[model samples]
Target chain A: MAVEVQYYVLLSMALFSIGLFGILTRRNALLFLMSVELMLNAANINLIAFAFYHGNLTGQVFALFTMALAAAEVAIGLGILLVLYRNFRDVDVTVPTTMRW
Target chain B: MIYEQIAFALFAFITLASALGVVLLREPWHSALMLGVALLSIAVHFVMQAAEFVAMMQVLVYVGGGLILITFAVMLTEREDATDDTETNADEVVQT
Candidate 1:
């Protein structure tokens, strides 16, 4: 049995939608970060699926770059979460409007 | 035709359910756990699509690295029930 491109695309769409809903509804900062990760991975899956179907390595290479970007994202995201937690004492992202200067 | 479609549908269902759990669960620890499951399922999906290397990296980086960092961050952060001091700071700025 072979997998179809439409199957992967539909799965990616479903994952992306779930991520969007999470980001929209979750007030917690950590959950928001997870949602962002979900969205990024969904895009990566799309790229890889395209790469496989087209027999081109470019899409897989792009997925590698996407994963690298995700690593950078987690670094800066956790750093910000740390600062937000230190000052706010909670990771709720819905509550900040001031800059520390 | 039917068996393959059924298997794919089941996998998709599992992936979506776990991903939903990751966000909907209130406990960050639980969310992290669900995220691990979701990542693993997505990796299986990747393998099913014949993207073997991507699938392996999905498990290695996402479940191994990303979820671990998320759990550590959650643990290090303040508890969910605490009143946010940052709110007070914002209030002070508005008053001044």
Candidate 2:
């Protein structure tokens, strides 16, 4: 019972869509970062699946790098979040006093 | 082989459900906890895909490091007296 790559693709797509929905609907900056993480994991799943399909370690290695980058992204994102809160007195993205659309 | 399929089905369900929880939950702390579940299950998925080392790193880096940072942000950013925490303008979701 070998699993098809398509199953993984579909799963990844569903996960990515959920992330997108979160990003679109949620105003919490932390949730926004978490949704970005979900989207990144979706991409990671694809890399690992295709690596398994091709019988190589490249995808796994790249996934590791992606995780490292994700960790760094979270670190910086949290820094910005703290600053946003400090200045705005709220976490709502729409209530910022410094930046406006 | 059959067991692998079963396991994939089970964990994939966990992954998606918790991911939804991460988004739809009322509390950001709850969402952060849900994010932990989603991250760990994703590690299990890496194991299923035969990337054992990646699975380990996923747990170590994502669950251990990344999730901790997110939780800290939630704790640090949220105010104790502020109770009006709500999403802003659901109307903007459909707009360009």
TM-score of 2: 0.92
lDDT of 1 by residue, B16-39 (tens): 999899878867778889888888
Model 2 Cα lDDT, one tens digit per residue, A5-101: 8888888999999999999988888899999999999999999999999999999999999999999999999998998889876677766644543
Chain A TM-score of model 1 comes to: 0.94
* Residue A2 CA displacement from its true place in model 1, Å: 1.5
Docking quality of model 1: it rates as acceptable
lDDT, model 2, position B47: 87
Residue range B1-96, candidate 2, lDDT tens digits: 888888889999999999999999979999999999998998888888899999999999999999999989988987665565445445543331
The candidates' DockQ values read 0.43, 0.55
For each model, chain A TM-score?
0.94, 0.95
Candidate that would win on DockQ? 2
